[model samples]
Target: MIEVLGENFIIQQIRDFEDSQFEQTFSGIDKATSNIKNIFESLANKSCKIVRYKKFKQKILNRKPWVDHEVRDLKKTIKPKGAKLRQEPFNLELKCNFFTHAEKL
Candidate 1:
């Protein structure tokens, strides 16, 4: 096995052994690089690891129903009176009107 192409390449750094030592010459540099790549990939496959984790499921909630027509109409009526009361805080008529409409709820 060629040192720089196989698993122990980093320790040896392919020292001392000459280019003359190996009898096989690749047809081109690309083929030589591919053989080294294959050896590295095989070693990586043996050492690789996998990890998994659980995902949190958020709680789903049902939407509340909107106010019905009669209650909606009552709020519309009362809202203007309450606004007028706030503008004239000392007005007895507006205060009384707002309270009377509010109690109809």
Candidate 2:
């Protein structure tokens, strides 16, 4: 944004300089030198505002792409099955499927 502002400022200064009393070419060498100096002075005085540069921010999305309805349902069942394993053992097939699905991620 600062770069855009600076560019516009320079363009405005140049237009103002061109619109002023200075001629494109002078009759004498001294007159030409003086005109050049005046132009330089005008540009030098019209300084751009000093602004701090801004850093770009990136958006982060926290989501598990692999977790579908099936995965969610499996997770719901797995918690109870895991707890029940302390008393009576759960089915090995369900446990194997859960591990396989989790590892696929």
Best by lDDT: 1
RMSD of 2: 12.9
lDDT of 2 by residue, 11-33 (tens): 67557656656456555556656
lDDT at 4 for candidate 2?
43
Model 2 error, position 88 (Å):
3.1
Clashing pairs in 2: none
Assess each prediction's global lDDT (C-alpha) against the native. Answer: 0.65, 0.62
TM-score, candidate 1, is 0.37
lDDT of 1 by residue, 1-105 (tens): 243345565334334232324436555555556656665565555556545678989889554386677777898999888888889999998888888889978
Model 1 clashing-pair count: 0
Highest TM-score: which candidate? Answer: 1
